[model samples]
Each structure stands twice: as C-alpha cells, then as structure tokens.
Target: MQTSTETETFGFIVNDISRLIRAEMDRRTTEAGLGLTTGEGRVLLNVRRFGPTRQNLLAERLGVEAMTLSGLVDRLESKGYVERQPDPADRRAKLVTLTDEGEAVVCGMEPITAAIRADAARGIDPDDWQLLLAVLKVARNNLMAARAEAQSAESAAA
Candidate 1:
C-alpha cells in the first residue's frame, strides 16, 4: 500500500497543476475579448472538444446540473457562439455545435491557449512532463475506477 506521504504528494502535485492550468486559462480567455465566465468558456470548449454533443451529455461531462447547463447554453447561444439543433438520433434532444464564428474564435484561441499551456508547463523538463502526464492518467483511471466501484457497492447495498 502507498503510504500517506505518497498520497499527499499525489494530491498536492495534481492540485497544483489543476490550479495553474485553470488560472492561466481564465486569464488568457479574458484577454481574448470574450470575457467569458468559466462556465461559458467550458460550454464552448466542450462543444469544440467533443464535436456535436447532446445538451444532456454536455451537462454530464461538465459535471453541472442539466438545468444549470441550460442557462449556460442560453447565454452561449445569445453570444452567437453556439447553435443548438435537434439531434438526428433523437428528435427531442438538442445537439449543440459551434457556430462558424465560434469555430473561428476557437481556431484563433487554439494557439494562444497552447502558448498559455506551454508557459504553465515551462521549467519542467519535457521528459518530466511526459512522466507526469502518464502518472496523472493512471491516477485518473484509478479514481474513476474507485468511484464506479463505490457506486456499484452502494447500489447493491441499497
């Protein structure tokens, strides 16, 4: 078993990277003229990241409630950055896609965002970054597996 000291190391380093990425993202996006709230930016990013996605799936991926995501989508739609269309798979479902303008913005932001990510990752050796990413990926899998096991156990207990 990993000692508590090892767990603390995992927690701190993971949290530090998460903070640096998020804070830098917030700063850079604000400079991009959208001045988007984190939620709004997340809505745009998720749309871009996963291609067209159902509104419910977007909410689930963002870990936000569907109703809250509804408001976020509403704001994004008003900005003309996203479009919601009926899902071809399910007529009642709405699929969100980036508008042409939104696509342009996303394209433009890509390099700038990359620069910020690179800056945040600066000072770390490339090999270290690779190793860190590998470790983080395993950490993510472990956490997800643990969560699934816990949920399954609770469901059976219930």
Candidate 2:
C-alpha cells in the first residue's frame, strides 16, 4: 500500500525528528552540571550503569577505539568519578567502575534524562511506538553485525 516516494518522505521525516531529539537532549544535558561534552555524560552513564566492566568490553560497547575510551576514562578518573581495578582473572586487564561521586553525578541528571526520552516519544500511540521499536531493533542488529563484518574484512585486507 506504500509508494516509494511516500516511503522516502517518511525516511526524511524520521531523520529530521531524530536529529531534533538529539539536539534537544544535548541542550538540556549541557544545562545540567555534566560539563563539556555529551561523551562525558555518556561515559558517566556507562560507568554508572555498566562499570566494573572490562576496559576492552566497555570500549566495544561504546563503539569507540581503545584510545578514545582511555581518554574518557582519564577525564572521569581525574574527576573522582571512576576508577580502574585489576580484573581478577586477567592480570593484564583492568575493570572500570563508578565511584560514589560518579553515581551522584548520574543521579543528578536523572530527571533531565527521563524528560528528554519522554519528550521524544510524545504523542505516539503505544502500539505504534512498540512497532517502531521492534523494527528499529531488527535494523540495529543487522547494521551492527554488518559493521563488524566490514571492519573484520578491512582488517584482513590491511
């Protein structure tokens, strides 16, 4: 029932909507005391939510390179927000965890985070929202696996 032109228009609308939501999140998050960059806020969140996580695994989850991850960790560690401990099974590896200060920082931003997510979803019917979520999840899985495969191929080629 859908035409190609209509589908294209819908894609453009979705892209613009996604951009607007991201910009709003950036604006409100900056207004919070998170400071500097969105990456910092994201790092704080990850360390708070997924800390005691291995550095490599954290880097993979963030979809960032090791150097980038290290830099984020450095800033957080300096702020007394995070710390690295030796992995029990791997002496060469370290686990990252959030300090009490880090938790406080993330907790303080909770209201803003919830507000942003809710605003982005405003006016969407429950069924439509769930359908969009399901489709997006499938698309995300395909893209992620494809990206990993492409990276592996490039590495092999190099």
Error of 1 at 2 (Å): 20
User: Which regions of candidate 2 are displaced past 4 Å?
Assistant: 1-22, 145-158
| Per-residue lDDT value at 118 in model 1 | 88
> Per-residue alpha-carbon lDDT of model 1 for 12-111, expressed as tens digits?
8768876776777777778887567777877888899999999999998888999999999898888898999999989999999999878876776787
lDDT of each: 0.84, 0.82
TM-score for candidate 2, residues paired by index: 0.74
TM-score of each: 0.80, 0.74
